[model samples]
Target: MKVIHLHQEEKKIIEEAVVQNRQAQHKLYVKYAPKMLSVCRQYIKDLQQAEDVMITAFMKVFVNLKYFEHKGSFEGWIRKIMIHECISYLRVKKEMKFVEDEEFTHEMHNNIESQFSVEAIQFLIDALPDGYKMVFNLYVIEGYKHHEIAEMLGISPGTSKSQLSRAREVLQTQINSLNKFNHGTI
Candidate 1:
């Protein structure tokens, strides 16, 4: 994979945007909007809603640009903002519910074949309940720990663990059913 290096002009654009330069800000937006929209879509099922969230996140990013310490990648900082906006949108729209940890005792099994495409895995995840989907995306896809997920979503770590466990079980069941259906055994 070829990495596209940001030229010095790109760095200057960010610096100028930090001071609220409109043209520089537009340049930054044009450069990052497509990638950021894709990130928002991972959390939001609706494309229009994802676009709204991405716009909101970009607004926050521009407003907070002055606070960026330049210690990390600018794209990373922007992506973090997009993720937070998605979580906030989910909280407001879906109102996450936590199942009791004790209720999740089933041992998880992976019935999904390795040959399945990424889209198939994503479709199974998208079928999960809101809470399960959020936890699964944060932990399995985004590499967040249970403690971090709990802090982000204002739930207990045990709740995060339970949701993730339930997500895996549900996904396995769905995959098994799909396999049976494909093989005409259903």
Candidate 2:
């Protein structure tokens, strides 16, 4: 079944939400909550905690709806908010200690997407130290520049690059190990 385009309706809902219309707010929440939760889960490994962050972010979104100009996708705007909320949650929940390495070689993990399930990849990411995971997700998943990540996470761009390099190395090692074990070579 083809779903009708939501942009026109979303604009109307967004306007109503700006005025604090409860039903419009509820509709927006129902439409966005699932995707927002997934965005939260990318940063937060715990589903329940991700949900909490998503809810908090949604509240902020509704509160700040008036500031949302029609220049971009509402989903993207919400996602940015969700990412910030996750960062805040992580900050309060755990300290992210970034390692400063300016010269680590970048290692790419190739051809694993076909072999690894999304959950498996997420598990590997979840295993990373908080700082590495945050940089890796921002750089790799969310396509943020290192400088942007550094600014957002309050670290140097060099530190962000280093964290990404280290994260790639660790994930590559783990995936290689998994490949060997699965192929009975280890």
Q: In order, what lDDT does every prediction score? A: 0.84, 0.89
Best by TM-score: 2
Clash list (residue pairs), candidate 1: none
- TM-scores for all candidates: the values are 0.86, 0.92
Q: List, residue by residue over 116-156, the lDDT tens digit for candidate 1.
A: 78778777877888889888888887789989999999888
Candidate 1: which stretches are off by over 4 Å?
1-7, 106-112
Model 2: per-residue Cα lDDT over 48-93, one tens digit each: 9899889999999999999999888889999999999999999887
Question: What is the Cα-based TM-score of model 1?
Answer: 0.86
Q: Candidate 1's error at 55, in angstroms?
A: 0.3
